[model samples]
Target: MTTKFGFTLMSIQEFETWIDARQLARTVLTIQEHHTYSPAYTQFNGSNHFALQQGMKNYHVNANGWSDIGQHFTTFPDGTIMTGRSLEKSPACVVGQNANAICIENLGNFDSGKDAMTPAHRDTIIRITAKLCKRFRLPVNTNSIVYHHWFDLSTGERNNGTKNNKTCPGTSFFGGNKVADCVANFLPLVTQAGAPAAPVISASAVLKYVSVTASSLNIRTKPNASSPKATDRDAAALGAILRVYKETNGWYKISGSQEHWVLGKYTTDVKRATVKADTLNARSGPGTTFQKLGSYTKGQELFIVKEQNGWCKVNMDDRWVSKDYLVFA
Candidate 1:
């Protein structure tokens, strides 16, 4: 294991042990898969992992204005897994759906006909995913493991990669980024990823999850915005998740014990739902005439943030799907 620039670089073997010993403070219901589209395979000459990681942190903190790197970890083409943001904090990867999630930024552009993934990189992705599943006691399915391509970029809703989505983790990633592709090509591998022991779960006291919509949400000492800022942390970056324990007068108690709170107006409630249809159309508007954005496959799960006209607005965005095909949980 290696540590540099406030990040830890570890081999897959080392990561397995490291993850097992961690005492994560928040619940992790899902694992996010992403790709560093810019620093594609071509940029990796094998010894620059630390430099690349620092560069990404610089971009996320300075350019994106995030509190830290957007992901919890980054998987490289050489199969190294480098730690980024704190595991205790929610990732800033997907909008609105980032709470209770762990993000993995794979170092490659896996778009169609681009960045032929190396064998080492491919193996690390699968193993890391499986290990996390086992560690979290999460079901090995599309809902628990997600691809960045499935969400709308602006609203952070899961519309199955409809319009306004970036083909992240790419279209050709592990066969493809489609939900069907995950069910067909990726999930089965995760199910068989490790020694097949019954998973041991670590419980969390989180009541529900909320995503910070405000570019920078203040962490108040009390439920109101007028309260002083928390001493430990000043702000919660947009797309970060807050583990809500209680609510009061448009404010949510984000900390379990302390008075850390944030205004509810800047955060949207998230609901997880599964598609009942073999293929459901996500539209630009609530009606059929709006525009067919994309199709969601049966059993695929996504986050819904709004409801209107018999349609569910996904991830607080313009993408809507017929409510007739949804089964909420």
Candidate 2:
């Protein structure tokens, strides 16, 4: 393992261990696969890993005007994985479908007749993807692990590459980039890729759930701030719901088996719920008299931070909805 230019480079084995120890605040549902069309195999020389990664970050920040590198992780031709953007933030790789998603940019053009996939690189890609799916409790399905070519570039809709889609992940990525191709060629490898178990505690075991009120909350190994970070990138983003398993001093244990703890001061009580009504209005205050911000369709997920009378605050801010329309999860 090595660190350079604000990125941590690790082998496939190290990544599996590192991922299991992380205590992410946001719930992840999908894993996006992409190909770095610009920095092809020609640019790689078995070295210069940091230089290439830093170049992408500079382009994303300056030219693209994004806060940081778009992808959360990048896979090198040498089978090394380098960290990019924060795991807490939604990736900028996919346009309209970044929420609750993790993006992996394989470092190659990967188009037909361009950069034939190396054996080592292929192994890394497969293993890392399987590890992420296991870590996030996501199933190895088309909806969970997807190719960049599946989404429309203009509308960010999942049109399955019918139109307005770039051959991203490419025409020759793992044989092909189409949904059918993924089902036939790519997904099987990920599903069969051997991965260790990720223990998830049942809801009954959870003492309570809390919503992060602060913009970013640091996760510590012990109950005190003096303890080391629980993981390399250890802060949970705002609006992330944490399941508290144990309480010690002023800290809350956010993980089931890991020693990950966070300050109770930065969090507020919350409940997991799903919208039961056909359409539920989100208001500024607890009453219908308050201004309506937006509406949530049926089956939409939300965390209730505060409840007053028959209304529930859906978020940390003033967003409120009728508790009558919610089914507690």
Per-residue CA lDDT of model 2 for 1-329, tens digit only, reads 89987899999999999888775766675789999998999999999999999999999999999989999999999999999998887688876557567999999999899999899999999999989977776667676788888766854546678878989898999889998899889878887896323334344477888877788889888999999986654588876678798999879998777788999999988887877987677777889999766555565557677889999986544678898999996
Error of 1 at 6 (Å): 0.3
Task: Give the per-residue lDDT of model 1 (tens digit) for 1-329.
Answer: 98988899999999999998764434476899999998888888899999999999999999999988999999998899999987767788987567668999999899999999999999999999999988877788776889988888875556777678899989899999988999899888877786233435335466677766887777788887677887665477665556688889988888665777888898877767788998787788888999776566677666677788899886634578999999986
Ten-residue region with minimum lDDT total, candidate 2: 195-204
Go through the candidates in order and give the C-alpha RMSD of each one to the true structure: 5.9, 5.4
**Clashing pairs for predicted structure model 2, backbone only:** none
Ten contiguous residues minimizing lDDT sum, candidate 1: 195-204
Q: Candidate 2 lDDT (Cα, whole model)?
A: 0.82
Q: Model 1, residue 252: displacement in angstroms? A: 18
